[model samples]
Target: MDIQHVCILGAGTLGTRIAFQSALSGFQVKVYDIHEKSFELSKKMIEKIAKSLVSSQIYTAEDIQLALNRLSYTLNDQEAVNQADIISESVTEDIEIKRKVWTRMGEIAPEKTIFTTNTSYLLPSSLASFTGRPEKFCAFHFHDVFYSRVVDIMPHPGTNMELIPILQDFGRRLNQVPVYVRKENHGYIFNAMLLSFLGAAGKLLVNQVATIEDIDLSWKVNFHVPMGPFAILDQIGLDTAWHVTHQLPDANSQAFAALLKTYIDTGKLGEKTGEGFYKYTSK
Candidate 1:
C-alpha cells in the first residue's frame, strides 16, 4: 500500500475520530456510513472537534483547516473506498454483518489496499477469513478516546509482513502508542482485563458487599484508575456491555451479568439513553 488516501467505513464516534486524526496527519480521508443521519452527525462532530482542538491549542488554525480539507463524506461505498490505500471498517460489533461488509469492501477496493476492522471483540483471524486479501488485513483497536495515544494492532498469521510498518508509522504519526497482540481472543488485551475487573465490581454490587461508591473508590483512589467500572460501563453503553458479557459463557456466573439482562431489558442503555448503573443526560 502506498498509504495516502484513507477510508473509514463508519461515521460513529470511533470512526469519526479515526478519520479526523488521519486527515490531521495529512492523509486524504473519506468517512462513509450506510446511514445518512450518521454521515451528517459525524460531519458536525468532526468539525466541532477540530475547532476544539484549535481552541485547546492542540493544533493551529491552519492545521485544523488542513485536516478539514482532507475530509469528505458519502454513502456510496465504492466512491469513498475504491481509491483508498487503507480501508478501516468501524461498523457495529456483529461478526456476520462485518463479514458481509469486508466481503463487499474487498471486492471494490484496490488489490493492495490494507483492510482493517476496528472490532473490539472478534479475533483478527476470524475477520481475515471474510476478506479477499487476508494477508493485508488486520485488527486496529482504539480505546474510549479513539484519538488517544493508546492503540492495539492485532494481525493474523496470514497478514502481510510488508504492510505492518506502514500501520506502525501511521500510529506514530498520529501520536498513537501502538502495541501488537499476536493471538486472537475475546477482548484482546485491554478488554480481557477490563471485562474481568468489571465482573468483580459487578459481583460486589450484586452481593451487596459494597455500595457502588465504595467499589468505585477502592479502584479509583487505591489503584488510581481514571474511572471506575460502573462509570466506564456507562460510557461504553450499557446495552453493548451487557450483550458482550453474556457471550462470555462464564460471564453469566459473575456479578456483572446477573443484572445484565435486567439493565438491557428495561431500556436502560447507559449514557446514550441517560440511565444505566448511573443517571446521565443527553449533553
Candidate 2:
C-alpha cells in the first residue's frame, strides 16, 4: 500500500534522522516519544539539520521546509498511532520494548497500515508476533544518521510480499539504498560487523591500552576509518554501547558484562552524563 502518514516512535538519533528524511520524501511525519524533553530536543535538532541539508544542496530550500512542515512532534501515544499510515519504531534496541510497541500499534492502527521496526538485532518474526500481524510487519533498518544513505528492509517469511515493490519504491523515493532480507537474523548486516568493533573499542578504553585521542587518531591515520571507536562510543553514549554489548551472548560476553556493569553501577554513561570513558563538562 502507498504510505502517506509516516509516524516515527522515538526521538533518538536514528529516529530523528528517519523522520526528517521521510518527511523530505513527501510523507507527513509524526515523531513521538514518551520523554517530553527528549522529543523537544530532537525536534529542534531536526530543524537545524534540515537547513543544513538545504545549504549543502543535498535538498532544496523548498524541499527542506516542506519536510520540516510535514513533521509534528508529540508525546501522545494513541494519537500518534492514529495519525500514521506507516509506523517506523526506532525506540530502543530492546526486543521487549519493540514487542510492546508492535502490539500497541496493531491495537491502535488499522490493519493495512504498515509496521516497520528499526531494530538491528531483533528478528521480524518475534517482533511481528507481538502484533499478531507478522504479514504486514517488516523491518526497515537504517544506518546511524539514517538520512545519509544505506538502509536495509527485512521481511519475515510471513511478510506480505505484495507490498515489496512499493516498499522498495518508498526507499528509493527517500533516496536510500534499500536491501531486503527475506530471513530473520539478529544484527542484520550493518550492526553485525559494527557491534564487533564496538566491543573491541570499549575494551581498549577500559583497559587503558590507548588513550581516547590516540585511538581516534590511529584510525584516521592508519585505517582512515571515518571516526574512531572511542569517539563514536562517546557520541553514542556509553550506556547504549554497554547495553548492546551486555545483551549479546558471544565470546566478548565476559568482558562486556564487566565493562557494562562498571559503567552502570558507577553512572559513567558517556557524553550525556558528562563522563564515561572520557570526562565531559558540558552542561
Candidate 3:
C-alpha cells in the first residue's frame, strides 16, 4: 500500500506522540480524538514536544514548522480516516472498547487502509475478528518515543505476510527499530520482560520488604540505570499500569492492581496528573 497518509485515533499520550513522530517522518498525519478538549490538549502536547526538540538542539524551528504543517486534527471519525493508508489506534486498553472501535472503523475506513492497535496486553488476534479485515489487522506496540525508539510489530494468524515488510519500513521512516514478534504473545517481547521486573518490585513494595525510594535506589545503584521499576511505572502512568496488571488473572496481580488503584482513585494518575508512585513537578 504506498503508505503516505497515516490516521491516528485517540489523542492521548501515545497517540499524540505517534502523530508528532509520523509528521516528523514526513507522513501526512491526521490525529482524531473523540472530544474537542482532547484535541486542544494534544495540540498543546505536540507544541511542547516540538519546542523541546528545538531547545535540545535536535531540530530547528523550521523543522518543527514542517512537522506541524504535515499534521492535522479532527473530531469526526470518518473524516479523520478518509483515505489514509494506515490507521493506528491508541485508545483505552479495554478489549471491548477496542473491539467496538475496530468494528466501526472497519465499516467506515477504506478497505485498503491497514489497521493496527497500540494495545499493551491484548493480543491482536483477539480483536482482529472485530475489524472485519483480519488480514489487514495487527499489533504495533511502542514505548514512550522519547525514551525508547523500538516498536514491536505482531501479526495475527490472519494477517497478510506481504504487509509486514511495509510496516517495518514505515517504522524505520519514523526512526524506530521495528522488531517482528514471531507469534501471538500477550505483551509481545518488551512488555513480557517488563512485567516480571515490575511484578517483583511491586511485591517488595506491597509486602513492606523495602520502601519505594530505597528499592529504586537499590536497582539504580546496582544497575547504574537512571530509573527503577517504580520510576518506570510513574512514567508509564499508574492508570495504564493498573490496566496492564488486570490482564494477568492472579492473586498477586490483583494485589498490584489494587495498589495502583489506590493511587489513581486519589486523582494521582502519574506525570500527567503530577503524582503517582511519586510526585512530579513537570508534565
Candidate 4:
C-alpha cells in the first residue's frame, strides 16, 4: 500500500527522527505524544537535526523548510490515526504500555493503516495480537535515521508477507538501508551484537575491571571508532539503556541497570539532558 500519511505515536528521540525523515521524504507526518513537553523537545530536536543536515549540505534550506511544513504534532488519538496510512510507535519500552497503545490504535486506526513498532528489543509477535490485527502489524525498527541509517523490517509469524516489500520501499524513501529479519528475534541483528558489546562494557565497570574512560578508550583506540561504548550509551539515553538492561535476567545486566538508575535518578539521562557518562554542551 502507498504510505502517504505517516503517524508517529510518540515524540521521543527516535520518533522525532522518523517523523522528520518521513516529512523530508514528502509524506504528511503527524507526531503524537501525551506529554506537551515531548512535542517541544521533538520540534527542537528536529530543528537541530535540520541545522546539521543543512550545514553538512545533505539537505538544502528549502528542503528542510518544506519538510518542516509537512510535519505536524498532535495529542488527539483519533485525529492522529484517522488519515495515517502507517503508524510507527515509539512509545515507552514497557510491554504493558505498548499493549495498551496498540490496542487503542487498533480500535481507532483505519483498517488500511499498517501498524509498526520502533521497539529496539521487543518482538513484534509479542504485541501483534494486542493490535487486533496481527497480519497488519510488524516491526519497522530504525537506528539513528540520519547517522546509522539501517531500518529493520521484522514481521511476526502472522504478519502478511506482502508488507515486507512495502516497508522496504518506505524505508528507502526515508533514506534508510532496509534490512529484513526473516524470523522473530529479540534485539534484531545489529542490536543483538550491540547489546553484548555494551553489556561487556557495563560488566567491566561494575566489576571495577577498569574505569569507564579506560574501558571506552580501549574500544575506541582498538577499533579506531569515534565513540566508545560509554559515549554510545550517552547517545542512547541512560534511561532507555537502563530499561533494556534491567529487563535482562542476568547478574551483570542487573548490576549495570543499578548503575544506570543512579544516573537516571539524578535526571542525567544522557545527551538529551546534557549529562550521562559524558557531558555534552548541546542537547
List the lowest-lDDT window of 10 residues for candidate 2.
Answer: 274-283
Q: What digit string (tens of lDDT, one per residue) describes model 3 on residues 13-118? A: 8899999999988999998888888888788778888889999998899998999999999989989989789999999888888999999999999978999999
Stretches of candidate 1 off by over 4 Å are 145-147, 251-258, 261-268, 272-276, 281-283
CA lDDT of 157 in candidate 4? 94
Model 1 weakest lDDT span, ten residues long: 249-258
Query: What TM-score does model 4 achieve against the real structure?
Result: 0.98
The TM-score leader among the candidates is: 4
Task: Choose 1 or 2, whichever is better by lDDT.
Answer: 1
Each model's lDDT comes to 0.80, 0.77, 0.89, 0.94
**Residues 5-116, candidate 4, lDDT per residue (tens digit)?**
9999999888999999999999999889999999998888898999999999999999999999999898899989999999999998888999999999999999999999
Q: Flag the better candidate by TM-score, 2 or 4.
A: 4
List pairs with backbone clashes in candidate 4: none
Give the candidate order by descending TM-score.
Answer: 4, 3, 2, 1
TM-score of each: 0.87, 0.88, 0.96, 0.98
**How many clashes in each candidate?**
0, 0, 0, 0
lDDT for position 157 in model 1: 88
Query: lDDT by residue for model 1 over 10-126, one digit each (tens)?
Result: 888678888888888889998889999987768777776877788888889999888888899998998998788888888877778889999898788887688888888888788
Each prediction's RMSD over C-alphas, in Å, is 2.6, 2.7, 1.3, 1.0
